[model samples]
Target: MMKIGIVGATGFVGNRATEVFLAQGHEVRPVVRSASSADRLTIKNLDYQIASAFDQSQLADAFKGCDVVIHSILGSPGLIRGSVEPTYKAAQKAGVRRIIYLSSMIVHRSAPAIGTTEASPLVEKQQFPAHPAKIYAERKLLKLREKGSVEVVIFRPGIVFGPRSRWVSDLASQLSQGTAYFINEGQGICNSVYIDNLIHGIQLGISTPSADGEAFFVGDRERVTWFDFYRPFAEAFGVDPAQIPSLPIPEFHHSRKRELISAVTNSQFVQKFLASVPEDFKQNLKNIVPKRNKSSVAVIPQVEEVKQVEHKPTPVVNEMMAELQQSQYKLPFDKAERILGYEPIVSFDEGCRLSIDWLSQLKQFETILKK
Candidate 1:
């Protein structure tokens, strides 16, 4: 049995990875922050170690005996330097044979270019929170090939959706107010990677010798539209897909202006400057421009009647979203298929059926948690 060490082993993706490795009769060890985190795990044939990825000593210790270390921790951009870099250092020190990093699709789509591929440029602007962090992490890991013996392989996945995904976890509650809108008026494509399918890709990456020092995107073979993806969840949430209103896709000018203002306002210097602006002047500007509420644009429009949401348009986020329902951001995984023999094992319909079953049970568990 292969000794596999998983960082962030209890999280959504990590939990599934843990199950996959364990069911294969591999000896699984979870690197968790607390001893109690192991209690959340229902599986047997596993052990645990208390160590944060930030602690190189403990991380090294955790990776000591494992044949391979899978770094699957999902955290803020801060962790790129904090944990990701350190974990790589630790794995090297521990003499781990291979490292599989869980990277996102944003590395290729710096600004949502059409037809994303592994060769797509790393996002130049670092627009989103994870974009810069992931690019930085990938650079550091790839640079390791020249310096170390660890096999560094990175696999980028699209927006992962399952029952545990926030998309459907509490969607029933989120849409209970009879307010729902089709995001971007159903213009966006849902680049959804089923959780199981993603795991399958990871397995191929792990075992494939040619995958070392390379990057690949793993996703479903067929493209699924956002409307079809949303409709299933809507039905599960008891909302008629037909009745949901379309969310407004902001014009480029408005979106750009809002993004610039937001980026500027987030800085202390700009905030201080804006803090001195007269309230009346700000109000007059608001009256003239009539800013679009971000919340309304983000969620489905609140039925036939539209109310403004109060948040700013996240342009970087929207860029990641596909502009064309069918063809936008069609991520190509030809490299994965060629190098690793990877293709989606779960079809969209089967994946959705499995997810709905899990969601139904999740609702019951959430009720228990509430009580």
Candidate 2:
């Protein structure tokens, strides 16, 4: 079994990586920032090292004697300037042989209709704050690979989702509460990578000779509109899919403007105005963005009859309520099978059931608290 050192092992991706490696019977040394954070990683037959990624001496010590090092550190846009070089040098000084870095698909050039790929012009563009940093980090890894025999593999995945995930959990919560929205007709196509599948891809990179010193796009072959992605979630939750309403793009934008204005004009009134709006509006806005490639294009709804629906307790609002009343959150899994040679052992349907069960238990506990 390979002796693997996992930096940021307590993080979302790093934790998953540690689990995968341990399951493969590899000896894993999980590097965490604090002893408290180390308690969360309860994997059997694994060792833990406490160190901050930014601390060169501590990182170097943690990486010593590892066959391969997986750098799973998170960064805002412009990570190249932030952490890449320091981590690279640390790994080199630690005598590490290979490095696997997790990056985002957004760093690649994207087509007008499709998402970005390894060969996309996005690799050259320095527009987005995140892209430049990701690209620079990947480049630095490549340079290190060229300078020595160190093998570097860059895995760029898009919209990673799974249990205990920030995005997926939030999405499931919104759908369960009957409070989700689509932006601009929600036609923007996006690539999604199931976290389990991502782990599989990372393993594949480790074993595959061709993957060394190269970058690969790790995502499900199934590309869908933002709306379609959420529709399955409704079905999974045992809700009426048709009850979920689609908000007009213009109206959503207007609401956002109002929210910004309220926040600026009256801090005290901001909370009240926000409370009056839909609970899911903020979460929905956070997830949805206009198509990056076709920024000006709007998603035109296919059904004209549906468009005439009045905007009071808006049809969209009523639809969400009805859907919530009937259904529960359902998770989707397909990308793992076609692309990553794996499938989510935990289905979205199962996830919804568990979440609801947990919530119900929490509610019961709260009732006891009141007594």
Q: Model 1: per-residue lDDT, tens digit, 164-268?
A: 776556444445544445665554666778999998988888889888999988888777767777677677666677777665555543478876765554443
Clashes of 2: 14
TM-score of 2: 0.65
In candidate 1, which residue ranges exceed 4 Å CA deviation?
177-179, 250-327, 364-371
Question: On residues 1-371, what C-alpha lDDT tens digit does candidate 2 reach at each position?
Answer: 79898887877888888887888899899987666668777574457887655556777888888888888877444323345555677788888777889877656532222333355454555333456667777887788677766688887776666655665666656765567665434455545566776787788777766667767666554545566566655565666556665565232223667745643543323433442444356657867965467434456778554344433333343332222222221222333233444443444334434434444344322232111
lDDT of 2 at 245: 58
lDDT of 2 at 47: 73
**Alpha-carbon error at 42 in model 2, in Å?**
4.8
lDDT of 1 at 215: 92
